[model samples]
Target: MVDIPVELPAGPETVTGDWTVGDREDIVLIAHGAGAGKDHPFLVGLADALGAEGLSTLRFNFPYVEKGRRMPGPAAHAIATWNAVVAWARTQEPSARVWATGKSYGGRMASMAVAEGLVVDGLAYLGYPLHAPGKPEKPRAEHLPVIATPQLFIEGTNDPFIQPLEQFETVVSTCQNARVAWVDGGGHSFEVKGQKRPAAEIGASFARVIAEFIRG
Candidate 1:
């Protein structure tokens, strides 16, 4: 196993990420969400699980967050950053199948990149924000159906970012190679009230699901 940090080129922002390379010929590259960086405990936990499964994992931060911005950077910049990271990961394991994975906003941007013809073996979305909370009409799924790469979306039943399960189902149904996993009683952050589980455990659970999906 190897942990390496690489630089991200996005103007004045210098972003770095942690990577663990296993002896396998498959890799999963993960990007953090809008409100956090690569060191987020959830990501760290998922990385641990993936490492144990013998699949390499790379987790990175976007330009905005690297610059200390709370909000996400523009779509063009996010896609560009992801492209750079993907390219770097390819250099690390040229023989490995490269899969893109992310949480929330990061996942959405990965979809956008796929739509724009960025090659990848698959995609895994930890919590896809199908639509903004209480704003179901403003969907963030126009490009999802067009992305042909095998995709997995793990969602929480109580997530406020996506509502009306029927709508999300409809979107997933249209995809040729898309699957969904429901985390019972969890919210957008995968926090289940009264369940009292640590974030790391929840993330590890989802990581196991992703490992299974990739293995299949």
Candidate 2:
């Protein structure tokens, strides 16, 4: 894994990322959720698993996480960070196809960036927070229909953020290229009910599912 520090266009602060190289010409750029950094165990495990499947991986922290804050910064900053890291990743491997994937908040920001003209081959959401917990009335999916790139949402069956599978289905149906994979009995983090597993194991388990989507 190579350490990469990305400098924002409008600021002096640099966000850190870990680049796990693979033999193939595809790369998955991953970002953390609101509460965690790039080095979180789940991300590390996912990166490793992707690497083993011959897909390079780049996992990075958003600006707020880099600044030691628990709450995420504005969407603009997060999108800028995504842009910077993606730009940097292209420089490292210009021939590789870059795709974006992230947990909850990170995934949402990636979608927003793509909606606002950031280019990517595709997108994968680990656990898309479709709405605030317990409030499905306000779904954050207005941008879903406008995005033309392929999308894969790996959501848990019991994730409160996207309760009532019908709501999520409706959103996906409007997209040009979108699909959803339900994790049976799992929560927002893909943790299954009454099933205890290490963070790494849980993260790695989804590698095959994501790889298949990317390969298609």
- Highest-TM-score candidate: 2
Model-by-model lDDT, in order? 0.84, 0.88
Cα shift from native, residue 160, model 1 (Å)? 1.1
- Model 2, 28-113: lDDT tens digits are 99989988998888998998999889998889888888779999878988888888878888898898888999999999999999
TM-score per model over all chains: 0.93, 0.95
For model 2, name the residue pairs that clash: none
RMSD of 2: 1.6
lDDT by residue (57-175, candidate 1, tens digit) is 88888877766889986788888877878887888878789999999988999999999989999999989989999998988988988988999999998998888888889989988
- Report how far residue 116 has shifted in candidate 1, in Å: 0.5
> Stretches of candidate 1 above 4 Å error?
1-13
Q: Give the per-residue Cα lDDT of candidate 2 at 111.
A: 97
